[model samples]
Target chain A: MSTVERTPSQWRVYRSYHSPFDPCPPRTRYFNVPPNVLQPFQTSARKQFAPHEALRKGTLWPEYFSPYPPEARGGEAE
Target chain B: MKAIWIYEKKLQYPVRVSKCDPRLAKMLIEQYGGADGELSAALRYLNQRYSIPDKVIGLLTDIGTEEFAHLEMIATMVYKLTKDATPEQLRAAGLADHYVNHSHALFYHDAAGNPWTATYIQAKGDPIADLYEDIAAEEKARATYQWIIDNTDDPDIVDSLRFLREREVVHSLRFREAVEILKEYNHTKKVF
Candidate 1:
């Protein structure tokens, strides 16, 4: 006992941490425009051409280019 | 700048393809200007657009894209028709030559299976000439589609063909309008 050397002792401290686990709530729905306030907008755009007139002029050719010819009345068997 | 809007002005026609028969599909594809007409129309519009005057560039570009869509529709019809065709049926349809060469590739072949060639398109660099050619091309497409409808027995195919033929008529009108716009532009410049 007399031959042993003594050393100074240091103390260590520990602390416990906790976090809350609250969940997020659902969001409430909102509308920008009132249901009754919205209305379809109509413009006074002039008619460019009548349907038959446009048809008569062949101006719609690009749209009408068919790839099939008319079917024969009784030629389905061949 | 408004080229997209101009192109969007194209009218759409709904076409129904008959899935039950391969022969009808092959025949209907022919109306898409098969081997020559629809491809030619697409190539012509696209090629001619480059030569269009600076003033009419927007119009030309729009028409070119529309032609591209028509080409797609035509190709779709062709593919649907020949998807499961027998060798014998293909032969009877005179498409054996193409099947042997391409093995079901949806090519720009005529009813007889001839391959597409570039001589189908034209671009003279003159707006007037180009417009005239467009009008003629539209008529040819209409006629061909009409012929296809006449030859096919499927009602579904006929309906689609009729729609396409009507589209050609619409395109012819649009080209005529473009020509009118060009004429007006030239007239104003002449006065200036």
Candidate 2:
């Protein structure tokens, strides 16, 4: 569920068009964007992730974290 | 060639395969030698760095070295997935061809079984062009990981793939920054 408001959340969402003519049912709504696109040139920040947490998530900064579709923040909705 | 990067026995990210699925292994092998795979990425950046502007050369070296680490991770994933599976199982998974050639061994080949080659990569010698290619490679790798995650049912494999996918995003950003840095260097040269 995307909106007009511009919050600096890590993810940006988009919907795939559902075509009735297609043979199969459309997939769940919303795709998550990689966080890098939002901040084209990175800025210095004091925020950081703990070492273990960084290793697990693959990024030291929380803002760079981009979750998979299955791990998307909220439950899927039309 | 003397220790450009120190060797670390440990994987940058842990890899554990909870199940043995030769089918998934066959697909995952693409990352090992596919045209857009990490090996091509590593060689491309490493070769391109020798000719790029001094300010951006180290960044290329850094990212290039990390790409080797990523190749290791992909190898680990493919090995764990197929390690215990039998010849029959691999055959059933359309890896019969793979096993015949290199039984229970990993080869640098794509999902379709094409051998790795230098043609997959480019070293344009133009810093901006090379950086742009690096960025494109990163995004393509990210998309490939996402598709693999979509295909597989195993949570463990998906978890590792997600980490690798995120790394691509970070690499892409760094390359983009390198492009900007090169631009600034050109602007400064004109003023001087």
Candidate 3:
């Protein structure tokens, strides 16, 4: 006999209500604009914060979270 | 930066092998401490993090953490596969060498019983070089998983291996993206 096929446990869909504590609960922010809207101004649009700026702001961007502290250099430390 | 890890009380992929298979256990150990195993992957990414810039650091940290979880899963699979197995069974399956070393306990070693070593990975301070190495590591891991999948008949083991293999593919993609971001950062820095 072939290996028994077991169906994975079905997960219950939990609807997440926006937490009042969250000032921007996704979709609430206009950052993820549709490509059509973002494409035309993409070149001239206001540039987003640099990696360090995002880190200082505690932004969710991954680029800013270095596990190691930056080195003593004035430029972008390690 | 503050550490972002939250302990998940479960394996990302469940390993529920139905029967003890010592040979399978031995083979699975390669995924545990083999030259291209999860342990190496975790260490490689974690150690590589210090020199990486922002986004790449985050990616490495996250992927490295996930590799630890994968390491645990592999360890668990090896434990289950060898559980309660007799010396005769171990010998018959060519796992007597491992049994002699660890006595049915999970030890970090490859199928050939080579202990895990630090030399398996490199964190070369260059982000581009490290990311490329990360990508290659993931491919090697995916290949090992596929090889294990080919060798195993256990559905539970196969399913778990498949999940781990898919994760390697995803990690490769993320590392590739990190490489692109690093290149862009360097390009912009040069321009400015």
Instruction: State the DockQ of every prediction.
Output: 0.09, 0.64, 0.02
Worst 10 residues of 2 chain B by lDDT: B183-192
Ranking by DockQ: 2, 1, 3
- Lowest lDDT 10-residue stretch of candidate 1 chain B: B1-10
Please say which candidate is ahead in lDDT: 1 or 2: 2
lDDT (10s digit) by residue, model 3, range B104-183:
78888888888889999997887778877888898788778867876877877776776676677557766766666666
On lDDT, the candidate that comes out on top is 2
lDDT of 3 by residue, A39-77 (tens): 211133454557665423322223222111112212311
lDDT tens readout by residue for model 1, A1-78 = 112222121111222332355354432221111111121111244344457645433232222222233122122211
Better of 1 and 3 by TM-score: 3
Chain A fold similarity by TM-score, each prediction: 0.16, 0.56, 0.17
Query: Candidate 1: where is the Cα deviation over 4 Å?
Result: A1-78, B1-15, B29-36, B189-192
Interface root-mean-square deviation (Å) of every model: 14.8, 1.0, 14.6
Supply candidate 2's per-residue lDDT for B39: 89
Off by over 4 Å in 2: A1-21, A27-32, A70-78, B1-3, B187-192
Q: How does each model score on lDDT?
A: 0.58, 0.81, 0.69
Clashes per candidate, residues 3 or more apart or on different chains: 47, 0, 2
Off by over 4 Å in 3: A1-78, B186-192
Docking class of 3: incorrect
* Model 2 lDDT, residue A29, Cα: 40
